[model samples]
Target chain A: MKNLKLIIQREYLSRVKKKSFIITTLITPLAIGLFIFVLGFILSYSDSEKKTIAVVDHSGIFNKPADLAKSGNTSFELVDATVEELKANFEDTNFDAILYIPEIKNLYAQSHTIFFYSEKSPSLDLEMVLSNRVKNKIRNFKIKELNLNQKELDALNTSVDLDPEPISDTAKDKSKHTNAVAAGLGGFMGFIMYLTVFIYGMMVLRSVMEEKTNRIVEVMISSVKPFELMLGKIIGVGGVGLTQLAVWAILIPIIQIIASMFWGIDTSDINQLSMDQAGIDQEDVMGEFSMIMSEIANQNWWSIIPLFLFYFLGGYLLYASMFAAVGSAIGDDMTEGQALTIPITIPVAIAFYIMIVTVQSPNSNLAIFSSIFPLFSPIVMPARLAFEPPIWQMILSIVVLIGTCLFFTWVAGRIYRIGILMYGKKASFKELFRWFFKQY
Target chain B: MNSILSVQQVSKHYGDYTAVNNISFELKPGQLFGLLGPNGAGKTSLIRMMTTITSIDEGSIFFNQEKINSDTPGLIGYMPEERGLYKKMKVGDQLLYLAQLKGLSKKDAKAKIQSWLDRFEINDWWNKEINELSKGMQQKIQFISTVVHEPKLLILDEPFSGLDPINTNLIKSEIFRLKEAGTTIIFSTHRMEQVEEICEEIMLVNKGRAILKGNLQEIRNQYKKNLYEITLDQSPADLSNLPGNIQEQVDNQIIIHLEDDAMSNEILSFFTKQGIRIRSFKEILPSLNEIFIQSVEEVEA
Candidate 1:
């Protein structure tokens, strides 16, 4: 036990004190902060871009139209010039594009050709604005020729909104309203968790390989038990990864505040404009934002945090041990290491893919099976938490994850003890199996 | 005195290949014992088994008259032939870490490490990374880490394989000092001169078995071939009919193997009777190297 402590101390201090460790730990959060700040800045900048258009209406339609004056990011000006004249003067007047509506000889006879000219590819929003105005005006004329009344037209233009809810009685009330934002957040968290486990698990693998290649394991084995050494290393490096993640989590909100200050962005103005465009009232948006925020604030972290930690650590330990065993089993070279780590890596990749699928269909039978399966549970369970699984399922998944982690640790310990000393021999499946059953 | 280490018919096998067959030897406290063998002759396997790095398939090893096991690591200082030390680790800190693992308190480990660094004249390298040092310099650190805990038994495999003459003498003197201070030492090497210099008892393992084992002086004496070398003042006239067969004759000296019933005096008297003056006469004892080769060949045959 004392030796295990010493081993853990050595492993932890040696890595934590590395220049690479400090640099990576600090750089990752700064990078993420920079990324989020840039994204927010771009969204607001593009939101404020407005364009003016010159429209030449030869069909005598929309010339004196009262309702088709200005839209959100687009406004029109009637130009009493030929297409050539308007094209030449559009750039001088800061007109983004010139829309030429050629005269229709017979309104019911054939289609009229319209052309839009610009110095560059027109923005999709600008195209949408012009096309919708022109299409509506033409349709109105077509309706008038048919002698349709305004009430019938209004009834024909009605739009329907959908509100999707889960059918489960337990979730009917809680999940009465589903939003894209919440689903996206759950998926993003799941992905970040997978990346953390992978990066740190590989760190454990590389450390073990280095010890073996340097021949340090021979000296170390004499001082401590193999199991103690492996456990110490896993815990030590895991702690470093955990520290990096914790710092990232804490620094994100601070970075958001700093970015808000630096950019001088007024969220209220952006929210008000968005609300006006969407025809939503201020109260409704505020209620949605506060509901989302409180849902986040009141998340049962007492349960979720522990479950996240359990899966996060359990998954890493399970994979890291096998990786260490592979490190010890393979010859001291990158090619052999790569070949051997493939088997271990495949499972992790499968689990991550299954996690993505689970985010889409949390209540699906496949998701349930994967979340309970030991190999996939670390990733799938955390993602499914937003869906709120049954208590029994959570307990079973946690138990299986912990159980598999412990079992693999023991098996890995056995392989590591024997393999650390074996060199120059390529370890085949048969050979590895023999090692597993070999008495120490 | 009680034996510090006793191995009785210990064996280790991997699959069908037996690395160390039924080998047995014992050494009393304060004795420097040499474990001699050629390459692939199981010297390292035997050492590994004794250190508990490898499991014994048959029989057992006792330290201080008690069976050795996992807990015996703290009592043994093992320097494997592979010469392993964390290359990126600083000398002082690495030594302290290894010593602490061997059951020394941090304070004790620090003090011991300091004194060892001072003794090795490497005080300036205390904070230098191991890879920054030359091979021989790193070797000195490895040796220090091995003995820093002042273990009761020191097992050194190829301790002098990479050392210069100066460093070799330094380590040899330390071995003598440790033995004098009542620490049992197992020195494994194929080199015979150093083994003969320090080892009070020795075992020659061949084909994973101990081919010859006894006190160093006794083994040499037992392998003596009744051979003698003598220098004469004048050349003897054709020693064909001499009392013993001449192995070689060079310059004024002749090497002869006496007949089983004959003695060295008989040859000396025969030369004297021939009106020749006897300048030097001495019996030649076989070296450990010679016995090692002959025994290995015999076992192979």
Candidate 2:
């Protein structure tokens, strides 16, 4: 234990103090900041409106209607001029181009020749408004000749419908309609964790492979056990990864705050809009949040946190130990190690992919089992936590994950003990299994 | 002197192929022992086992008569053939860390590393990253780190592989100085000349076994052919009755390779009869390189 601590300190400081490690830690965060900063600028700038349209009513037919243009991101101007006068002033570059609706004998025939021009293409909204204006002008003229009252016209423009709602515990937050959406987001985060572990865990493998291939591990194993060396390296590099994660965690929130300041998003407006758009109420968000939080708060966390930490840490160690062993087994050089990394990482990769597709249905036998299974638990458990799950199932999953860690730890250690001293020949799976089972 | 290390018939077998086959050797306190072999001769495997970097299959190793196992590996320093220090780590930092791993406290490690750097005239390199230094300089840093804890045994494998003459001498002197301070060394190299100059005892291994092992002088003598080079004012006369045959004739010397333990009187009498002034007469010893080649060849044949 004392020796292991010494090795850990050495591994941590040597790696953390390295110029490459420091440079990467600083560079990664800076890049993410630059990316977000640039992306925000582009999004806000691109959303501002471009060309404007001018409207003209020739037949006095649009006199008593609501104003056709709203002044928000878009602007519309009404031009009080006759067709001849507007056409004569066409050389003016102030307006992109003009829309002229000449007085017509047959509205439908004349409407076919509707004019819409701009310095470039006009907006779809502007064209729709222009067409609506022409329709109204002709309709009013027709109505004026028949002497139809405003009440009669109003009565003819409306329709009726009926809708009923179902009541449930999830109904309140369901109004905002994101509890299910929250499940989807949970799935997304699970996928991200899966991918992150896979990516950086392989980095652990490669680091082991590199040191082993170069025979550096031979010197290291002199004063340290193969297990200590493996633990120290995984933890040391794992600390580097955690440092990166902490930076991202801190930076992302800061970016979100900065972004929110520049682009204001009103909850009421978004909720109301979604409600009107989706025909669901906005208050369901409240019900859904409580449901999700209550579910999260009720988990068997004493069991899960330990199991999760075990699986999270143990899974990495188990795989990384085997990776280190494999690296040691490849005594030649780096090219063979590079070629071997793919197969070494395949198990972790499979766990990640399986965790991703199964997160939404965590209690779905697959996710639960994978969460309990040691090889997949590093990914599966975190993902399963996102959805509401039964306590016994969480316990079972956790038990399985713990068992998995213990099982693989021994297996990996056996391989590592034998593998760390081997050289000059590449080890295969069959031989490795043989080594693992070989008695002392 | 006390024995600092002992290897008793230790053999390392890898699946049926024995890397080190029953090679027994020991290093006494302050003794600089050399392990010689050609490429693939298992010198590294033996060193690895001695340093506890690799396990042995057939026998036990002892550190100061305490059987060496996991409990006592810290007492040995192993500088492998391959460069093991993290390249991107600063010299002082890496040295300190590795020293700490070898059981030194931070304060002591720092102090020791500083003095070593100063002694090597590489105080400026302390802050530089390992990768930033030239190979010789890196070797120096590695050497410093290897000895930082002042272990009971120090093992170096091809320690001069990439060094220039000046740097090589610097390292060589430091190694001698370490030995003078009572450190036992198991030095492994293919460079036989180094062994000839510094090593008192040597074990030459080939094909995974010890082909020759003894005092360096004795081993050299074992390969001796009693060859002699003599310079005379004129060719020695009475040649028809000389006991030993003259092998070759140079402008000023007669080269004789003796096949028997005969008295030089016969040769001396012939030289006197011819009235030749014998300028020089001496037997040349076999070089380690010649002995190594001949041994390998004899085994092959």
Candidate 3:
């Protein structure tokens, strides 16, 4: 145990002191911040400028003047002119497009013809506002023609909107579905977990491959047992990975805060924040905004954090051991270890796919099953546990993951014991299974 | 009286292929024992078994009568045929890390590492990364890491292959220094001169078995062809009375080869009768390489 600690400490220090580690840890967060800022800026500017369409009202019924500003961020304009007059100078290009609705033969034609100077997909905001203004003008003309009272006119024009309420409330875990902030956060964390494991796991593999290629493992094995050397390397590289991660974890928030405070970011801008605009409120927007912010603040990171560390550390060790085993068995360089990478990587990649699809659907069966699988659990379970996961499932997943880690450690130990000594032969599945069965 | 390591009938196999057949030997304290063999002769397998690199297929290995496993390897130092120091790691840090692995405290590891670096005239190399060093220089760093704990048993395989003359001498002297300091060394090499120079005992393995194992001098003597070299007055021309094939005749020396390892009284008397004044007479000893080849060839025949 003491030796293992020594190994871990050495591994940690060697990497922590490296120039590359320091540079990468500090630069990545800055890049991410810049990406978010540039993307937000582009989106908001595009959404702010609503498309404008000029209407040529040929019929006397086109009397309602278009408003510059509507209820929300939408507007319309109307012109008193004939279709031919508007069409002659439509290329003047002040409006996004000029719409012509010729007097319909029956006034009840199922289709209306619209044309623009150039081909383009019509903007949805422009389409909605144009249809509403035309309908309003017709409705007012009809009211006057019938000489209906205001109450009857409202009754004739206004349509009832029915909102169906489900018999059951699915918002049982109010925190789970309100916004995908937790899920986004979970996905972000999952990306981090997966990336670091892959990078440093490959580092361990390379370290072994280099030593073997250099023929140094032959000597080191004499002083240290294959398992000790294998464990030492895994623990060492993991320590390096952990140190870099811990540094990033601590530093990124600091950097983000500095950047955010320097530049004012409007949280309520849907275009800026990439939020769904359908549920947006005109007056009570601040209420929804604060609810989200408060929910983010109230997250019980204390519980989720320890679980994150546990899974991250366990996942690193488990994967690194296999890397070392296959790395030594291959007896050459990085290219040879690639064959070993497929088996190691496929499960984690599958888990990443699951994390991306089901973070919002934590209750989905795919997420549930993946969260319990040891190989995938390192990424999935912690994400699910960020919100409230069932206590039984959490415990069960951890137990299963820990058991799997132990079993793999032993299996890696066997391969390492056999593989470290056998050289010039690529690690074959038949040999590996044979080695596993021929336990001494 | 205490042997530091004992290998008892250790055999190793790779599925159906036998890599090392049954072989056994004991190493005593303060003795430099040579393990001699050719490539693919299972010398490395035996060394790996002793070093806990591979488990014996049919036998046991002990350090001071205690079984050698991961925990007990601290008592042994191993310098493999190929040097294994981390090339990217700073020399001092690499030494300290390896030293600490052998259970040394940080302060002790540093101090010992510093002493070793200073002793090796490589104090300037402390901050130097290993990749910056020559292969011979890298070999020195590995050699230091191997015995940094001052282990009771040191196993070195081809410890001299890559060194230039000066570095080789420095290491050879240091190895003797280690043995004098009570470190039992199991030296493995194809270099016959090194074995003859340092080893008090040896075990020659070929085809996975110990063809010969015993005192280096005793083995040589026991397998001796009893050849003798005599340089007498050149004026005495009647030397044909001596019955043996003449192996060679250099200016003042005549090498009389023998058919068997027998006493030389007959030749001594014949030369004394010729009234030939003797210049010098000494037994022509068999070299370890010669004995190694002879032993393996005998096995084949």
Candidate 4:
């Protein structure tokens, strides 16, 4: 136990003292800050400029000038002008586009005759906004011509937007539709989990390879048991990874806050963005944002954080042991490491790919299968946690993951005991298996 | 004399091929023991088993009559044939780390490492990375780490393979010094001259088995073929009738293998009887190199 501790200290300190580790730990948060800043800037700048359109409506359907559809970034002016005149004056005017409607008695006939002219191809946003407004007016006109009461039609429209109410006793929370936030956060967490596991596991693998190639492992094994040395390394490097993540977790938020303070990123801009996207007013957007903030504040972080750590450590050890085995098995070259690592890496890659499936359907069969599987659970289970999966599944996943880690660690240690001293020969699966079963 | 380590019929096999087959030997405390073997002769296997890098397959090993198990590794210092240290680690740090792994406390490791570096006259290289040092310098660091913990048993495989003459002598003196300080040393190598120079006891292994084992001088005497060299002041008119069969004749000297019934004194008297003035007479015991080759060949035959 003492030897394991010393070995862990050596492995951890040696890596943590590296210039690369220091540089990356300090630089990653800055990069993330820059990324968020750029993203926010882009979001605010999208569709900021207003465009005017001259509407020459020959159909006279939109006769009420006050009833014309207008938004903050788009406005329409009714003009009595021919298409030829409008086209000739299009470039000289401040108007961005000209919308022409030829003479028609009905909506079906107007569809073919309506023309929109612009200096360049029209933006999809502009096209969507104009077409939806025109369609709504036509629908209202058709209803009125049918002798339908407008208030009754509006009531029918209101009834179609049915919002289901939750039962008083069984429902966990007030929010029924948290899929949007869950998908975003869950996807982000799973991806980062996969990436960190992969990065740190590969570090352990390379570290073993370095020791073997350097021939230091012989000396090391003479002092400490191979299993002890390998376990120490896996835990030590995992600790380094966790430290980096912990630092990033703490630093990024602080950096983001500092950046927001220095750069004056107000919530109004975010509200404006939401308003533009949903075509809702500022008050509705403000209400939605607060509800989201409250939901975030009420999250069960105590459970979520420990679970995240469990998956992270479990997944890391599982892959790191396999990597260590490969490191022990391979000769001096990295080619064998690459080839062998593929088998270990595929499960992680598959787990990440299934994260999207988890987001789409949290209780999906594929999501449950992956979460239950030890290899994929380290990534999949945490993602499913965002949807508040049944407690049983979490327990099963954690238990299976821990069991798999223990099994692989033993197998890897067996191979390592012999492989570290083996030189000159390229390792084969047959030989590795023999080592696996060989008694010490 | 107290035997520090004893191997009782230990054997290791890989599939059908035996790596170290039923080989046994003993080392006295502070003995400079030589382990001589040809390529793939299982010297490395025995050394590894002794140092706990690999476990015994069919037998047991003991240190001070106590069975050598996992806990015995901390008492053994092993330097593998292929010298290895973390190349990116500083000399001082690497040594200290290895010493600690061998069960030295941090403070003791640091002090021992300092003393070792100073003894090697490499104190200035304490902060230099391993790759930045020359091969010989790196070897010095490797040697230091091996003994920095002051283990009871030290195993060095091909310790002087890549060292220059000066470094080799330096390592030799260090080995002698360690022996004087009561460290049982196992020196495994293909070099025979070194065995003669320092080894008090030796074992010759071939094909995973010990073929010869004894004190160095005793083994030499046991393998001796009664060969003698007689230096004459002048060439004899007739080169016949020497008591021994002539092996080679150089100017003013004759090398002969004495017949089983003949003696060195008889050869000298025969030379004097032939009126050839003898300048010097000497008996030549087979060198360890010659004995090793002969014994391996005999076993092979």
TM-score of chain B, candidates 1 onward in order: 0.91, 0.90, 0.91, 0.92
lDDT of 4 by residue, B1-301 (tens): 8689999999998778898999888888888999998879999888878877777899999998999877788888888897688989998888888888878889999888888877877789888999899999889989988888888999999999999999999999999999999999999988888889889899988889999999999888788888888899998777776666889998878888877634778877777877778888878989898998898888888
- lDDT tens digits, residue span A1-440, model 1: 99888888888889889898888877877786677666656555543557677787887677565634877666778878888886666556777777888776665754656789877777665666666667667778767766878787788875555666558867644423343434555577678778977898888888888888887887888888878888999988888888778887887777767766776655565677556545567996788788677667655668777778888899889888988788778748778678778887787889889888888888899899999999888888888887678999998988988889999999998888888888788876667778888976
Model 1: share of true interface contacts reproduced: 0.73
Docking class of 2: medium
Tens digit per residue, CA lDDT, model 3, A28-133: 8788677666665665553465556566555456654443345244444677766576667767756666666555344444455544332465566455555655
Q: Can you write out model 3's per-residue Cα lDDT over B37-67, one digit (the tens) per residue?
A: 8887888778877877677789898888788
Ranking by DockQ: 1, 4, 2, 3
TM-score of decoy 4 = 0.88
Ranking by TM-score: 1, 4, 3, 2
lDDT of 4 at B129: 96
DockQ by candidate, in order: 0.68, 0.51, 0.50, 0.67
Error of 3 at A49 (Å): 13
lDDT of each: 0.82, 0.70, 0.76, 0.84
Off by over 4 Å in 2: A14-52, A56-65, A70-89, A92-119, A124-178, A262-311, A326-339, A344-356, A359-362, A416-440, B234-243, B257-262, B265-275, B293-301
TM-score of chain A of each: 0.82, 0.70, 0.75, 0.82
Model 3: clashing residue pairs? none
Q: Model 1 misses residue A302 by how many Å?
A: 1.8
Lowest summed lDDT across 10 adjacent residues in model 4 chain A is found at A157-166
Tell me which of candidates 2 and 4 scores higher on TM-score. 4
Write model 2 residue lDDT over A1-440, tens digit each, in one string.
77677666665666676688788766766676566656645433422554445656555555553554543354455688755676677677355556655555654453444566555665554455556656766777767766779688888875452333447766332222323443554465556556556656666666776666655677677777777777777777666666666667686667556544655633344455445434455576666557656655654467545544555565666566556666656656666666666775676778777776675455577776776676776666766664545678767766765676567666777777777666665677776788887643
Model 3 CAPRI rating? medium
Per-residue lDDT of candidate 1, residues B1-301 (tens digit) = 7888999999888889888889888889888889988888899888888878778899899988999887899999999887678888998889989999999999999999999989988789889999899988988888898999998999999999889998899988998889889889999998887798888899988778899998999888788998888998877777877878889999889988886735777887787778888999988989888988888788888
